[model samples]
Target: MRQNHHDGTKRWARWEGASLPTNVRPPILADGRHSSGLAGCKGGGHGDPKAAFAKAPTFSPDTDFRARVAAEKFHLCRTTREKGRMGPSKSSNTAPSTLQVHRTSDLRRLLADRPTWGRLACGVPFRDPRWLAPWWDSFSESAEAYALVASDERCVIRGVLPLYRRSNHGYRDLNFVGDGAACSDYVSIACRPQDSTAVAQAMAAYLMDVRDDPDHGWDGVEIDGIAESDETMRSFAQALLVGGAAVHAHSRQSTWLSARRATWEDHLRSMAKTTRRKVRRFGEQIDGAGGLTKRVAETENQVDAFLDELIDLHQRRWRAEGVAGSYHDSRMVTFIHSVAQAFFLSQRLYLPTLWKGDRMVSAELHMIGDDRRLYCYSSGYDIDSSHLQPGRVLLSDTLRELYRRDWTGIDFLRGDEIYKRRMAATPQRIVCLRVFSPSAAGRIRFETWSAGFNAKQWLRRRLGIPPLSVVGMCETGTPSR
Candidate 1:
């Protein structure tokens, strides 16, 4: 068996600051979905250099028992700053002290002492027990999973960064990001308000130490998909830079419409004349189609039927075009079913469907959290029913309802489409970065070749590529967008 890094004696030695020298292994050129290079490492490129960095997450004691322990053992203090804003406070406060790093295994001990990990920031209540089981399961079992927990002796709660160790199949290169790729957003360090810096320090300490240690295998941590407004993202970026690691700032776009308007017309009027006309026309058609109705499934039990219908409609559309669908594979179906069920139970699922009388023609699965309504997956009629423009109507009506629910905006997720443009929702970029070490030079070379291999997949758009997906030759089944 691979050496257990968690043995008590070795663990104790690590706790007292023991270092294990690990050699950087050559990057492997694996053949699989990850290396096919179909998926572009797109999204944000580098951003401005002079922005003020957000302070790192620390620990707390009064309300944050974890902070108390860090205070005793690491002389850690809680600190806070707005996301993206950089430079020390101009008000003459002393410059923030340098943050430190901790190891991945050592994080759990900190968690044992604290009451819990960081608070779930989004509206979905991320820290709930329901999320823990599945989150941990994915982390432990997935080919890629890396986590760091921070806590004090006083409480089991402190902070945690649940990251994944990802490898691109085409490149055979490794990188890290939050656990769920297509399902989650707004990931950052979860901790008490006071422990921001400590959390940042711990993250830096852990990453730097891992890079320097030959035993711990990692090129570097590329914390992906962090909201531009997250303090942890800022702090982590600074900490990485200080540790002699390369840092890049990239921009991501999320489309949102302000819902605090006096009237729906007020919202509608904000759109360009062309978009407003399309939306208005679409709604009229839906209303004419035997009265379109909308429903929200309140319980997990209700989701299966909805998902079943969605899959049916989606499959029908693709098959009609002589293409494949996700439902064709039991594994894809099972994965979607599992994720949907888990999301619903956690009250994280926000699937809305529109039906004409008894016939369901359109559906959109969304996640309601972080005060943002995320457009996760959607499907609708392909029959070209002029009256029931199923897809268009569903989205239009959904927006009106979302406005009522006080959601700030809709992250239409990734990809580009005509419907997205009509909604006046702008596109945001999500860029992926690959950092290879001297040991993994082989992997880096493979990735460069794989990127080219994958780029050739665009030719098959007439066949069955996903809507605007980065296509690769190694990719088989169609992607259910």
Candidate 2:
């Protein structure tokens, strides 16, 4: 029997010593191993289901209970509201009365109602069955993840929002992970492209209603990774803020690299002089030194090798420093491989590798989203090739191709690297906001070191001193231009 703990809730499978529930499906563990403190699946996930993407399979939970649990959890989740908690709104109790979980069939109908849903609903290479299966259990319970259908008097499904509940500090919190930092790109709240505005309004209203529920169990929501160009997202954010959710903070959480200009040279001119010089020098050395060539993976089989090289490069880079890059695990590698395939087929995955003959010396895994080339991850020769600068060579070549392809800008997302600044890239700040009721349990303990009590914390950010909290939200920084 498996047992799990979430938000002060404990879940245990029914077991009569040696006997197990006849109906309980075995948990699908990602690997035979489980983390000491974290809940894990029964066994590791099996195989890469690339072919699964073609049909956009409907992901269902193992049982009816799992489904319901996921839905309930989502309803209890909060939306990213203002930075502070105020008195409950008079209409708090007037929000949506009952939350419903949309089934696969319902999801299909809603997608039919709004076709652009296809863009998001369509499975990508990176998407895995296991990544989504928890929602079944989550929605079934009043826990972490859930989904709801927006409807009218005729019971027509107008839209849907998938949400997750998380507690940070002393307060309960909710957010669209689609809008959180974990997602490489903004999570899409799908609607018919034509009803973008209406959908946004409906979502805002639903979130507001959810917020007003006393049992909502969250103080506020913190959606930190919304794209700058999403009008519907902007509308929803604005509505939430004006609806009394104050905009205590905002920042650019991620950057993008798009093909915009007529030529790569024009793109270079848009960067700093030092950056241009470095790229030119790197290119000259790579081209003049050996039969070095840069190539992108285009076939399914080629992707496996390309991904292998990516993982190897990342591990090699970090292992020396006693660190593990994000993709160090097999499951994570599998996840990236899945996403990369979908992105590649959509002309969205960019893997630029420098081949020194038959071996890859450096490589990068980038994503093509909307109109931008997302520089998601990279690994390459940094020391021995300091003179050769294989990484820079690969990056410049990639940028030139991106320019020729007419992408908007190269997004060097979230890192404060000297190379990024030298490229004339402007810093875009990503901010997370938290809120709490005045007297929630553990509230005082959570805020014992809050800015109100620690004036030095605020002064540190202004004086360019690092803030003291491990949580990124505690620091205050200026917004990017």
Candidate 3:
């Protein structure tokens, strides 16, 4: 049997001798008219059954017609079941709640719907408006709020794509608000899982619609740190591709430690024998060095002091390597301070300083997700206390405590540092998705940027250096214009 789909695709099913379900409509014939005969049977023919069957639509006895028909029905049922699970489909013309785009230039306007936004953020601390608002407060001097929000006909928010527009080298581009020096991971459209595809399609359509508007149009878009497995972002890219936009993607790996063990000892035992030994030795060394203690900033009043110490230590460590650290930028410092305060108020900040008696040995900036997972955002350690191995010792202690407390997991965030691997954190892939509008100007910009990026990659390979990363480039300096 042949069937036509609304999307202009055709599906063919082979039929063996089987009765069709009463509710199953008759198949459409090759002439695009419904056949009055029962499926798999000859119409009104009173001849020999074999002769009549020969003239019917060809069927293979090997094919299970009933099973195929059942499967098709199931697919239709599933699609219908999910159709309004996350509001109406954006592509449907008769959708009861058509998705609408609400563009805002003020972050405060977006925050007015904080409760809904937070729900849509779905427990990713970095994507929370609480985090992005602070980031924008500190970095807004260089960018304009261009957040795209999607709502249903009833004004109920379905998704949010937190972005800011910036002009670079005479071209305007849009980027995620919590990006740049913050180095946010798992960044993507904020929406419920069921609504992701519809939300993404709506957002993509909004972008395409505004591509030519003088005030709202953008030359390109660059979204980094989205997880490689994020179907929402993949759907968004696919939608843009279907709209003739040029999209580029790059993938990188992040490390995560499973922390679901019942006890700290059990967690240690699960690690490789060598790793277990190293963790023990590191703890012993730190203990021998005047015994280590962790001091967490339990209140907002302590946020600034803890953050200042982290910055000082981080800059010192990086300067020793002859490179300015991420905190070296004044804007970045301000951004971090603001983010720390906001996250602290939200009970997601996990700033801790490791001390050896009177000396601060290491500090880590972490964020707690709604799932109780810890995201190790950034860290700083006293290079002067290398013998004590402050970083490793602190990490070991942190993991032990989190495991004992029944935390879901601990992410090492981005980068593939040897220490993270030695600690037995598994790798997860993240990707950067870039799209150029389908306009002439967008095409020119994409070609120019692509050529330069390719040249950089070629040079890095020739020099035996690792591939370039958007995060690395942002940390080192402003992204290539």
Those runs of model 2 whose alpha carbons end farther than 4 Å from true positions after fitting are: 1-115, 119-143, 148-160, 166-172, 178-198, 212-217, 227-234, 241-259, 285-288, 370-379, 382-384, 433-456, 459-481
Which candidate, 1 or 2, would have the higher TM-score against the true structure?
Answer: 1
Q: What TM-score would every model get versus the actual structure? A: 0.61, 0.60, 0.75
lDDT of each structure? 0.46, 0.44, 0.65
Better of 2 and 3 by lDDT: 3
Pairs of residues clashing in candidate 3:
none
lDDT: the better of candidates 1 and 3: 3
Measured by TM-score, how close is model 2 to the native structure? Answer: 0.60
Q: For residues 321-421, could you state the per-residue lDDT of candidate 1 as single tens digits?
A: 67675466554465556667866876677887777778787877665555555545545464544356677777777767766776666666544455666
lDDT, candidate 3, at 309: 87
Q: Write the per-residue lDDT of candidate 3 for residues 1-481, one digit (tens) a residue.
A: 0000010122222112211111122222211223433234221111111121122222222223333223333433343234322222334232222454546665665665567777788888778877787777777787877776655534456778888889988888999888877777888888887666556766776677668867678999998888766767765765465455766666655545555577677778888899998887766654565588778899887789888988888888877878778877798888878878888988788887888888888988888889899888778889888887788878777777685566777888777777766666787666777888879999898777777777777687799977644321101111110
TM-score of 3: 0.75
Overall local distance difference test of candidate 2: 0.44
The TM-score obtained by model 1 is 0.61
Q: State how far residue 132 of model 3 sits from its true place (Å).
A: 0.4
